[model samples]
Target: MGIFDKIKEKLSHEFIDIIEWLDYTDDTICHRFERYQNEIKNNAKLIVREGQTAVFINEGQLADVFKPGTYTLSTQNLPILTTLKGWKYGFDSPFKAEVYFVNTHLFTDEKWGTKNPITLNDERFGLVEIRAFGSYAFKINDAGKFIVDIVGTDNNFTNFEINEHLKSLIATRFTDTVGEAKLPIELYAANTTELSETCKEVMQPEFNSVGISLEKFFIENVSMPEDLKKEIFEYSRLDKIDLDKLTKFKTAKAIEAAATNEGGTAGAGMGMGMGFVLAQQMGGMMAPQMGGQQQAPMQQVNTMPPPMPQAIQYFYSANGQQAGPVAFEQLKALFANRTVNKDSLIWKQGMTNWSPLLEVEELKAFLGGNTPPPLPGS
Candidate 1:
C-alpha cells in the first residue's frame, strides 16, 4: 500500500485504533492498549464518591473516555458538572453506586405542612414523629441511555427537582394505599408498627417505577385525642366492674336467706308456748261437769249412805282390806269437777303405784280438758 494510503487507513480505521496508537509506548503499551480497548468496548465508567452528588447523561457522550474513579472539576474539560457543584460524582459499577445514594424521594407529602400531612401521623391517625423518612437510591444501568435520555451533555440537573418529583409520586401512591385501607381510628392509633408495615407493603410497587427498592419504613409514635384515650381506659376496666357487681349480688342473697331462717325459728318457738297455755285453760273449764256426773252416780249406787259422805272410799276384800267399789259416778265426778289434779297423777310400772308428778303446771297445760282422772285415795 502507498505510504499515504497506509497513513489514512491507520487514522481512519476506527476511533478506538487511533486512540490506542496515541497511548502506546513499550511492552506496557500493548497492555495499556488492551485495557483502553476493553474500557471503550464496555463503555467508560465513572465513580460517584461517598457523600457526593452526581449527574447522569443519556446522550452516550461519555461512552468513550469516562474512567471509574472519584473525580472532581480540576479541569475545564471534565465532561459533566452536577448542579450541586462539589456534590456531584459518578460510579462505574452498580456496586460502586451503592456507596453513594442519589437522595431521591420515594414518597412525599403533598399535604406537606398541613394540619394532617402525609406522614406517620396520617397513617396512624395520631401525633407521630418521623425520625428518618423514606428515600431511594439508583445507579445508571445503561450508561448510554443515562447520558442521552437524562442529563445530556450538560451536568446541570438539580437533585431537588428529581427528588421532588419522586416525592410527589410516592405521596400519591401512599395516599391511595392509605385511603384504601379504611382502618378505624382507634385501631390505627394503637398499631403504629402495623401501620408502617402496611405503608411499606403498599408502596413497594409504586417505588419500583422510579428504579428504587424500599429498604424499610417505620412508625415512631402515635397520639390520639384525650377523650378517646380516656374512653379506651374505661372500656378496658369494664370487666373488673362487672365482676365486682356479681360478687356483691351473691353476698346480698346469702344475707337475706340467713335472716329469713332465723326469723322462722323464733316464730315456731312462740307458737308452741301459746298452744300449751290454751290446752291448760280448756282442761280446767271441763273439770266441773265431769265432777257432777261422778256425784250423781255415787248417789244412786251407794247402798249405805255415802260411806263417809266422803270424797273417800273404804276397802274390804277377802284376803285383806281392799277399797270397796268406788262409785264409777263419784270417780267420774272427781275428775270432771276438777277435784283432782289430773296433771298430778303418776303410775309406776309393775305395781300400779300412784304418785304425784313434779312440774304439775307444765303437765296440765300440755294435757287437754279430756285428761284422765287422778287415782282414788291418792
Candidate 2:
C-alpha cells in the first residue's frame, strides 16, 4: 500500500478507537447516557403476580442484589446508582433498584389484618376502626394523571401515604353516599356491620381511580356517643318505674288491711255494751211474774219486818261535830241511778272522810230558795 493510503487507513482506525473509548467512558462523561441507562433499569417493570413480587436493579449502583422473586419497593432501597465508581467505591450499591409489589399474604394471613367490608347501612355520623397492615394491591390505573397530578414522577410513594390517602378517600365517599342514602340516625347507631358494608360500597368507585380493589373490609369496632348509650339504657329499663309504683301500692294496701282489723276490734267492744243494756231491759219484764207467786202451805211463820230507813249523819264545817240527819234511802237511790255523782269529791287530806253533801232533790230545793246557811269560807 502507498504511504498516503496507509496514513488514511491509520486515521480511520484511530477514529474507530476514539468512538469505542467514548462508548466505554459514556457512564462518566455523558449525562444523557447515564440518565437513559437509569431510566431503562428503573422502568424495567413487571406485573406483580398474586403471590409474588418484582425487583428492579439499576445498571451500576451499590445495592443489595435480590433473588429472582418480586419484592415491594421501600425507602430502604432507594437512589439506584448508574456509575462504575458508585458501584465499586460508594457505600451504596451499584445496583440501586426498586423492589416491586410483594405478596403480603405470604407473611401474613387473615389474622394479620383485613380490609373492612362495606355494608348497606353506613351513615355520616358513624365511626369505625379499621385494621390493616403492609402494602395493599393497587395499580396506577390513570398512569398519566397519577404521574402528573396525583403523585409526581420524582416523588417516592410509601404505604403510609397511600393508607392515609385511602382513609381520607373512604371517609369522604362514605359521607357523600350516606347523605344520599338518607338513612335514619337510629340505624347508624345500631348497625355497625351494615354501616361498614355500606361504606365499602360507596367508596369502591372513588378508590377505583387509585386502582385499589378493596379486597375485603370490616368494622373492627364502632364508637357511639356516651349520651346515646345512656339514653338506650334508660329506655331498656323503663319498667323499673312501674315496678316501684306497684311496690308502693302493695305496701299501701297492706296498711289498709291492718287498719281494718283494728277497727273491727273496736266495733266488737261496742257490741258487748249494747248486749248488756238489752239484758237489763229483759230482766225488768220478768221481775213482776216472780213477785205474784206465793206459797199457801204456811203453818207457824216467823216473818222479818222491812228494815228501817237509815239516816245520813253529817258534820259541821266549823267544829267537825255530828250535826244533822239526811235521808240515806234518797242518797243511795240518787247514786244507783247516777243522778248524783258520789265519786266527784273535792276533799283534801286532813279534811273529813267522804260524805254526801248534795242529793239531786237537795240541789233542786236549794235552787228554789229552801236555803241552808253558807258554811265556813263559802
Candidate 3:
C-alpha cells in the first residue's frame, strides 16, 4: 500500500462511511448534506427515510435518485453516477458526490391568494371586482428535476424562496379559470368546489415544471368588495323572509281588532278591511303583468303597439306637490294606495304638460272605470 493508502488502511478506512439527512426542518423543502469535506466511500450506506428522496450530483451534473429505503452506494445502485464517475472498476473505489435529501411527502397548508382585486368582465353582472384566497398541498414527484432545477447548490432550499412564485402562478391561472366560468361576482363565493378543482387543473402545467404534483388544492373563500358583500348579505337575509307568515299574522291581528268593537259594526268593518287587503294583494300581483304602465301608453298612441322597454321612469303630483321621477313600478305603487286618479297630474319626461293621470291612457286601468263617486256630491 502507498503512504496515503497505508495511512487510510492504518485508520481502517478514509472515506464517507454513512450518508444521511436526519436534521429536518419545517421550512426546508430540500436539504443537501455538507459531507464535512469527506468523500463518499464506494460502498457507503445511504439511508433515505420515508418521505425523503436522495439525489446524487457530481461536478454540478445530476446523477441517480433514490427513494425510501437503505441503499448501498455502488455502480449497480447508481448507474448514472457510475457513468459520470467513469468507474473503470465497477465503482469499487471511493468517489466524491453531493447528496441532497428532498422532502417528498406532501407539503401542506401552502397558501395562495390575490393580493389585489381581480377585475373580470362578466356576462351578466358586467365588470366585477373580486378577491379570492386559498391553500394548497403538494409534493416533489420528480426528484431529479427538483434537484437540478430548484435545489441546485442550494444547501437549504426552503419554501419562502418559492412561495411567491407559486402564488404568482396561482394568480395568473386564477384569472383565466374564474373568468372562463363567466359567473357573476355575487355567485363566486358559492362556487368553491368547482373553482378549486378547476383551478388545480389550470395550475397543474406550471406546477409540473417546478417538479411538483398537487396533492390537494383548496379555494377557501372568494369574496367581493366590502360594499358588494354588505348588499349581498342584506339581500340574503331578506330573501329568507316569509311573506305568507306575515300575511297570516296580519290577518290574525285584524280579527282581534274587530272582536273588540260592539253592535256588529266590527263585523262589517272587518269584512271591508279584508276586502281592501285582498284588493291590495291582487293589484300588487297584476301591476306589471297587466301593462298598467303610464309612459308607454302615450307612445303607442302615435304608432302601433311597441314592445315593453326593459325599464320605465315616471313623474307624478299628489297632495298639490310633485312626488316623482320614479320607476314605473314605484309610480304603480301610488295607484295601489288609492292615491292615483283621473286628475292626479302625472307626467313623463316626453309629455308637453302635466295632465290628469287618466289622460295618460296607459294608467286608465288603475282607475277601474270609476270617477271616485264624484267626491260625495262635487
Candidate whose TM-score is highest: 3
Best by lDDT: 3
How many steric clashes does model 1 contain?
Answer: 28
TM of each candidate vs. truth: 0.30, 0.31, 0.62
Candidate 3 regions exceeding 4 Å error are 1-14, 230-355, 358-378
Q: What is the TM-score of candidate 2?
A: 0.31
Q: Any runs in candidate 2 off by more than 4 Å, and if so which?
A: 1-151, 177-189, 239-378
Q: 96, model 2: CA deviation in Å?
A: 16
Q: Per-residue alpha-carbon lDDT of model 1 for 106-173, expressed as tens digits?
A: 23221111124444343333543222134343333333333344443332344443455555655566
- Relative to the true structure, candidate 1 has a C-alpha RMSD (angstroms) of 32.7
Q: Give per-residue CA lDDT, model 2, range 1-378, as digits (tens).
A: 999999997545432111001122211111111222221232232233333222332332223333334433323333343343243333421223322222222111122123453333334335433222222233334332332334333323444445557655655565555456666544545565676677677666676664445655554544445675565465556667564333333333333443455467654543443344334434545779877988578687759788644333222221233321212332222333343453332232244564344433333342334666699997
Q: Evaluate residue 374 in candidate 2 and report its C-alpha lDDT on the 0 to 100 scale.
A: 92
lDDT head-to-head 1 vs 2, winner? 2
lDDT of each: 0.39, 0.39, 0.75
Clashes of 3: 0
